[model samples]
Target chain A: GAGVSQSPSNKVTEKGKDVELRCDPISGHTALYWYRQRLGQGLEFLIYFQGNSAPDKSGLPSDRFSAERTGESVSTLTIQRTQQEDSAVYLCASSLVFGPPRETQYFGPGTRLLVL
Target chain B: AQSVAQPEDQVNVAEGNPLTVKCTYSVSGNPYLFWYVQYPNRGLQFLLKYITGDNLVKGSYGFEAEFNKSQTSFHLKKPSALVSDSALYFCAVRGFTDKLIFGTGTRLQVFP
Candidate 1:
């Protein structure tokens, strides 16, 4: 794809329901990232995927949040037993490089999840 | 740890006037700075970045930012503001590692 693509642009789920968000990064990009943005708040880092290596899950808010990536391609973010506090816009980004002085990150349109 | 800070919640500027969005960062090593803009119902668009060259880095959409080492700041600026430039701006900082930390963001409102 020419740019990062995310699925289910908007989602409204009841509290305690599980939700899955998908992301497809640009071809040949080596790095991917997930972030959460609450209403009127900043983007919060969630996880990072670099190739087939173990993903950097340091930013996951809790055990209910998990993510996986297939090689260097599509990635999915799953939230189990979502809470009201979990309602936010989930964003995906990809970069051509992932090392020091990394280049610009191309962001997806983002999935707006509303936990009612 | 690496982090970026955008102190202002919002900035209002008149068309054709100069505009600035302040940003500051804290990192362990040399800093890699970036600026991104976002419009309503859209994704973030890359504006510019500062790596290892000149203090002033130019980017897309006639936007530019100055990197200040002593002040630990990288402020985005434009000589003239346009109403179309109204959008949300984010500042990010990455150290010598792969991690990129972002600031809260600043909402820029340009009036005609």
Candidate 2:
């Protein structure tokens, strides 16, 4: 892929319902990241995956928010029992590599999730 | 913990005028600073970053940012503003991990 791509540009779910957001990183990029942005706010780090290493979940808002990445390929962010506060744009980004200081992160168009 | 601060909630500039967006950061060790731009209904786009070397870093859209270590600031600057440059700008600082602490976004409104 030329750039990071996310599926279902917009999602609407009822309160307490679950929703799944998908991300396909750029080809061969080993680093993937997820972020949440409220209406007009800055990004909030959700989670990140780097190669085969254990994901750094420190930023996940809560246990309800979990994500998985398969061998540096596609990744999915699942929100269990979604709340109204979960309504925000879910963004995905990928970098060619990590550990070289600030690796430029290419972002996806983002999936707008709205919990009604 | 690493954190970033964008003092201005909004910056208004006229076309053809130089524009500036202020940013400051706090971190334990060396900080990796970055600026990202977001257009209407779009995800953030990386504008530039400050890692090492020169204090000035140039990025896309003919914009550049100066890293002032003494001030712990990395302010975005453009000599000439364009109407198309109106957007939301964010300053972020990378921690020891991949986590990037972001500041409240600053909206840039360039008037033609």
Candidate 3:
């Protein structure tokens, strides 16, 4: 089966610019999530989207980070005024559903963002 | 807050030898534990998870983990190591929230 997919395998942008990373979840998946993985660090939760529900933006580090998912398919994570600290791998994952005894999350290759 | 901890930054083991990577978690209620691996320059790959039922959960690529409720641990283990298994392993835990809290990660290096 097709897995989650992300675009722009690698991105290089100047500081103060805005960058958008895209994610396409697996077919039939009803939940999507975005996370940030800094070099040699753990993954930091960014946002989550469930079918027709308000996205969870609790993990966004600041107002600069935001994400949106249309229906239950694709999601885009936008970072405004990118900073050096924003340089990291942006990963997307999706599952069949979100609930108790949560389903396994299938991940995408990720978009490596570099801010210069 | 829910959190996970991988005590070792790195673990080295010879091929054909058993290997273990430690993980401990802290959460408010019953925890949903997970294991994921990342190859160099690749995204995370789900290995296995411990939601309930059996204490020992088997996962992809001949890997398994033991969920110890009393200890609040879910350590990944493999009977024999393969060089191909070398990668960054992450332990994660989810409580009542929709997000998973991940550990710092453990790098596994298997020598031949």
Candidate 4:
């Protein structure tokens, strides 16, 4: 069985450029999550998709950040006009389900975005 | 609003010695605690989690965590440390479901 996978393992782009990071969740994983890990800091939640619905988008840092998932499948996070401050490792994770008792979230290798 | 704190920025231990990474959390209700380890150039790997029933929960690679409700702590422990275990460890708490609240992470360095 495959785990979560992300594309563009490393990306270096100029400030004000836009980048789209892709994430392929594990098969049958209904819950997908996106998190940003800045240098020497904890992971900051970005967005989450349960099936095709985004129940929580409050974690998006600003209007420039948006993510979409197509029903328990691939998800794309688009950072419109990226800034230097957006330099970080974007990680994707998926779980069988989330809430209640407890479920483990499997993480991906992550896409390291560097804004020049 | 829930929060988690890994008090120590780093923990150093000799191989074959016991190791402990401290994590404390604040949540409105019952807390679901979890441990994750991230090796260099790798994503986070699930270590273990504590939801209910057990105070001491054992996880992969002989790692275990003790959930102390009174102390509001869930510390990851290993009886014997290994150099290969040197990595970044994180503790997370899920209270509300928007997302899991993760700690700042603690770098564990196991020396041989």
Candidate 5:
């Protein structure tokens, strides 16, 4: 079976510029999530999208960080006016469904963003 | 808030030797525990998870973890180590929220 995939394996952008990272979840997955992994740190939850429901944006560090998933397929995480601190690996994951007994999340290779 | 802690920043073990990576969690109600491994320059790979039922949960690549309810811990363990098993391991917990809270991570180095 095909696993999750992400585009732009690496991205380098100016500090003030905006960058968009894309994620393609596995087929038939109904839930998708985005997270940020900084150097020497743990993964920070960014956002979550379930089929037809309002995305959970509680983990977004600032208003500049936003994400959107169309239906139950691809998703895009956009960082507006990127900052040096925004440099990190953006990872995406998806599962069959979200639950009390949550399903395992399959991850993508991730997009490494470097804000210079 | 829900959180996880990996006490050791790094663990070194010789190949064919047993290895253990510690993880403790704090969360309200019953916790959903997970283990993930990351190779350098790559994304995370799910190892295993402890949702309920058994105390010991087996996962991919001959790895397993024990979920201790009273101790609030879910420590990853392997009976024998392999050099190829070296990587960054993370313990995560999902509480009442939809998001998963991850620990700082533990680097495992298996030397031949």
Candidate 6:
């Protein structure tokens, strides 16, 4: 794809339900990131993946939030037992690579999740 | 830890006037700065970035930013504002951890 792509642009789920969001990064990108944006809030880092190394999950808010990436391609973010506070826009971004000075990151449209 | 701060929640400027959006950052090592723009219901779009070299970095859409190492600031600037420039702007910093930390963002309203 020309840019990062996310699926299910909009989602509404019950408070106790689980939701999975998918992301497809640009071809050849070796770095992927996931972030969440609450209403009127800045983007919050969630997880990061670089190659086959263990993902940087330091930013994951809680055990309920988990993400995985296969190789350097598609990634998935799963939020279990969603809470009302979990309602937010989930964004995905991919960069060419990661190093001391990272390259530009291309973002996806994001998935708006509403936990009712 | 790395962090970014955008003090102003919103800025209003008239068309053809100079515009500025303030940003400050804290990091352990040399800071790599970036500016991104967001329209309503849309993902962020990269504007410019400052890595190494000149303090003044020019980017897409006639936007530029100046990096001040001493002040720990990277402020976005446009000599002549346009109403079409009205949107949300964010400042980010890449720290020693190799992760980008974004600021709260500032909404720029360029009125005609």
Candidate 2's docking class is medium
lDDT of 4 by residue, B1-112 (tens): 7999999999999999999999999998899999999999889999999989989999999999999999999999999999999999999998868477899999999999
Expressed as tens digits, the lDDT of each residue in B61-84 for candidate 1 is: 999999999999999999999999
Q: How close is candidate 4 to the true structure, as a TM-score?
A: 0.98
Give the range where candidate 6 chain A is weakest over 10 consecutive residues by summed lDDT: A97-106
Q: What interface RMSD, in Å and to 1 decimal, does model 4 have?
A: 1.3
What TM-score would every model get versus the actual structure?
0.97, 0.97, 0.98, 0.98, 0.98, 0.98
TM-score of 1: 0.97
- Tens digits of per-residue lDDT, candidate 2, B1-112, equal 6889999999999999999999999998888899999998888899999888999999999999999989999999999999999999999998687767889999999999
Q: What is the Å distance of residue B67 in model 6 from its true position?
A: 0.4
Worst ten in a row by lDDT for model 3 chain A: A97-106
RMSD of 1: 1.0
List candidate 6 stretches off by more than 4 Å: none
Interface RMSD (Å) of candidate 1? 1.3
Task: Write down the RMSD of all candidates, one decimal each.
Answer: 1.0, 1.0, 0.7, 0.9, 0.8, 0.9
| Per-model fnat list | 0.79, 0.74, 0.90, 0.74, 0.86, 0.60
DockQ of each: 0.78, 0.77, 0.89, 0.77, 0.86, 0.74
Candidate 2, pairs of clashing residues: none
Error of model 1, residue B18, in angstroms: 0.6
Binned by DockQ into CAPRI classes (incorrect, acceptable, medium, high), candidate 3 is high
**DockQ-better candidate, 2 vs 6:** 2
Pairs of residues at least 3 apart in sequence or in different chains that clash in candidate 6: none
Better of 3 and 5 by DockQ: 3
DockQ of candidate 3 (2 decimals): 0.89
Question: What 10-residue stretch in candidate 4 chain A is worst by lDDT?
Answer: A96-105
lDDT of 6 by residue, A1-116 (tens): 48899999999999999999999999999999998999998999899999999999998999999998989999999999999999999999999978855798888999999999
